[model samples]
Target chain A: MAIIDSLKKISDTVWELPATYKEGMRVPARIIATEKLVREMDETVYQQISNVATLPGITRYALCMPDGHSGYGFPIGGVAAMDVGEGGVISPGGIGFDINCGMRLLTTNLTLDDVKPHLKEIVDLLFQRVPAGVGSHGFLKLSHSDFRDLVEQGARWCIEHDYGWNEDLELTEENGCIPGADASKISERAIERGYNQVGTLGSGNHYLEVQVARPEDVRDKDLAAKFGITIPNQIVVMFHCGSRGFGHQVATDYLQTFLKVMEPKYGIKILDRELACAPLDSPEGRDYFAAMKCGLNMSFANRQVILHRIREVFSEVFGRSAEDLGMRMVYDVAHNTAKLEKHSVDGKEKTLLVHRKGATRAFGPGHDEVAARYRDIGQPVIIGGSMETGSYLLVGTASGADTFFSTAHGSGRTMSRTKARKQWHGKQLQHDLEARGIYVRSTSWAGLAEEAGPAYKDIDEVIAATELAGISKPVARFTPIGNVKG
Target chain B: MPYQYLEDIGTADIAFEATGRNLPELFSEAADATMNVMIDNLGAIEPHDTRQIELSNDKIDMLLFDFLQDLIYFKDAERLLLRVRDAQIDKKEGKYFLKAEAAGETLDAARHHQRADVKAVTLHNFSVEKENGGWKATVLLDI
Candidate 1:
């Protein structure tokens, strides 16, 4: 039987894989997707999510969002919350290697009419200013000790250094700096790899795009106006990136540490080596958590600096200061991260370690953690699509607590990069996008070819499923007008 | 080519199978495969700079895993694109030790045709085994 056959339908958009379907499962596995998407999902996602279900102290259900796909230990778009007081285990695999890899959106006063004539110039300048691709380095020059302070301080450091406006921090997740970042727990190699990579857009599905919200794409006019997407053809800038090499090295260093101690020291046996973990309160777990926060801070700082450079680029191009251009931030949301959040479990309030790997936290309205400005409307969720396709701006729904207030991250990959490269020529794709009025600049032809629109699932379909599932509600859809691909 | 990318294994990352006649050869071939994912033209990376790598692990598979991560470390930390020129693997005190010489230059996008920025080596289905009287390793690189 197909794996889909084993899933018991819970709703129009939710399916459940009972714990009995897999041995050693602590809880059932649930996937949030429409019937069509569930059938089209890669077989490995089921296996991987089932593996995730077996981890220690997992609560409720191991959840997979609509954009779920096969990843190493947990399926991309996987969400699992564990009760720390109940011997909950924290796995590096659960948060992913690129810690806090997330999306950021900035609303601009310009419109398509204002930007069309200067699309190429803006994109080209962004491509140059925000270095992209493999071996790309940012313009920042920080000493070893300075780098340590930056990670500990996160985007606040950028504000102090004049890289961002002070108001920007309030709109960012965790006020742009996660607490408990101990540079002492991080490896020197991680610091070395990361100190110079601040502000760079790393390659493989990462991009900096300038988009527009046409009137027709606004699904909820009231909500759209609240989120600053009111102007027809309103131009906005969005980008996806993470901690770069710094996060990768932090995860790698801890993965090695956990592997050496997981079984012998902790007596925890995992089916996959990548699922290696330790108890949340264990010494190894606390150290990794602290180091991981450093990765989170590094990324927050990374995007903060990129936003600074972006403000400069836009200012230089349009002959107006970024402030005069009204480049106010919408919100920044992290897709890959683990956070300690308070949620009601079995009708009792509890602090849970919520792990969202390739998933975004969609905190509903009135949540205490929601930014004060958005507390009434709920947290804004930024879902990035492929460069050829468009993206969406959604707000968390009150009903989203079902999966610990988590939702889909992107129009997740439907094909492999190697296969996409084999199927499309980069130059031709670039020409095609240009003919359609979407201008692009990329560092590698092969990299561009690998991210063709057809290489991913339909963005509209993914959005429709999320809305139908009530995990997040669409506020507006933005069409890409210009992009800088890494 | 001692290595070939596995097209069907991973949809979001790059996976490859590498083979060699001996332990050292296996390590070198895997190193080349990992670097090849980043730079399309591995041969263009001249041996302008060199670094010696020394790592030991109780498990043989992790030894290969560590060696591959070391290559990525150089690319990220030093901007050096290295390929293992030679390697020696030995067993002592129940641990496997690897010592190797790697050579390459700081990455020049104008000279080196870059591809995806490989993030890390994932041990999901990662394996190193003796196959058909030679050594074979299946690896996945997070890009």
Candidate 2:
């Protein structure tokens, strides 16, 4: 592993791959992981991050969180900030294919004990209510103009259509709407592909899981109380998905264009074609950002609508109003996105394009961009683990700002899906999870095999690494009772 | 080589390679490889329907990339799991053009065993090259 010798250990939990390690690097690449965990990492991530450091106008450092692993252009848990004033660039690889792909957590008054007997019924209802898998269609029929409005208005469109409550907006990142979204920048092919998939969970690793938060797992009492997470075994529903094929098409469309224009228009060269990018101030960059915003909005709408469906299921099953059951959103965080923000760099505030691919923002207290209620405590960072292993709820800290306010997105894969499938048969794996008290509901048994729990890194350990690194602080933990996969 | 999925070593996405006697055959095999990433049972997709696609590009690399993107688009938009039944590539006015006919049926999950949902064909490690008497291509898919 290149990490063993080439990178210099900065701290017990941090390592620095110096700019001198590679030929074209303008900035050093920083990684947050212990020596024990770093040994599992191969040279691929070192290459990708160093390559990222070589991009024109890359600011400060190229960073990878504790859960970092090799991915397409950026490592899965990579974070980079570029100076827009100095001709910084934006690449689709930095945002990933599933634009605004994120996790949403909603808390309820009902506890695990209260919902235990009806767990199977609730999961079954969610599976039926929300269409999933490839080609899964939703009843959100929209005309061209309506769809365009959806792309523009985001979750607000669904709330206006009575799909969800207006209050739900307040709990979402960017209030469930990203600015500068222009439907005009979106292609007809992308619109057509997104039309039917607006409210569906399009496959692989995307799921809606019902979980329980025990009093014992609440690490921070005050914060957990603030998040409406109280009582032992409190139930919360969490889902992971994105803009479906709409986002994919948008990324595909831009990447091809970037590749065609990179040399002629930007006078920039990259180590890999997958890292194709244009200056942030250039026409190509602006156009792709506009199109990407549309993807962001579409995903917001998709999740809002899904949340509405989930609330309805709870209301129907428990014979109580959703509000009475305290079915309110805790927070929503987009993992794959690039946002323009003002950050203090080298003691001066600069407008930087922060690209977090498979990483989430962990802005600490007093950031005005965060929700008013959470402004004093910082943004909630949702870290999803495997179905059986449970998940974590962490909060941004003041020290986290060093990495430009970012943290690991999930328990990164320790093994590939192919290997997981080879080792475990889907039916048998399902039975095993059931034996361990997790109900597995998926569109395909074969798909279930690929997501077996043992394939991922230890979630508890990854969370501990981040906390020890002083990037983020853990507040609460969740164990899954039931889950529905696409 | 027809087509085969390479086990992912350092990445989370699916990677595969395809080879054939010519560019046209290589594209067909690549299509098969792409579809196999989604469904293992190609036999389940009966050839009762057909869709024709004509794509033109100055570069062969972009042409193949766009062609693969089209298959994913068709599957999502039309719910059709197509197999390239016929293909022809020609150079017109110094630009490359491809015309192909694909046959398949609407995806019936009960009939077909589905795998990962390939989101898009990625440019990461994507390539097309000539080797021996034939040509080969490598693709990585984001799921």
Top TM-score prediction, candidate number: 1
Candidate lDDT values, in order: 0.93, 0.88
Write model 1 residue lDDT over B1-143, tens digit each, in one string.
Answer: 59999877778899999999999999999999999889989999999999999999999999999899989989988899998887999999999999999999999988999889999999999999999999999998998
Off by over 4 Å in 1: none
Residues B63-124 of candidate 2 have per-residue lDDT tens digits of: 99989999999988878899999999999898999999999989998998888788998888
**Model 1 C-alpha lDDT per residue in residues A50-151, reported as the tens digit of each score:** 999998889999999999988999989999998899889899999999999999999999999999999999999999999999968899999999999999
TM-score of 2: 0.98
lDDT of 2: 0.88
- List pairs with backbone clashes in candidate 2: none
DockQ (0 to 1) for model 2: 0.70
Candidate 1 chain A lDDT trough over 10 residues, lowest sum: A223-232
lDDT (C-alpha) at residue A441 in model 1: 91
DockQ of each: 0.84, 0.70
Q: Model 2, range A329-399, lDDT digits (tens) per residue?
A: 99999999999999999899999999999899998989888898899998999999987798999999889
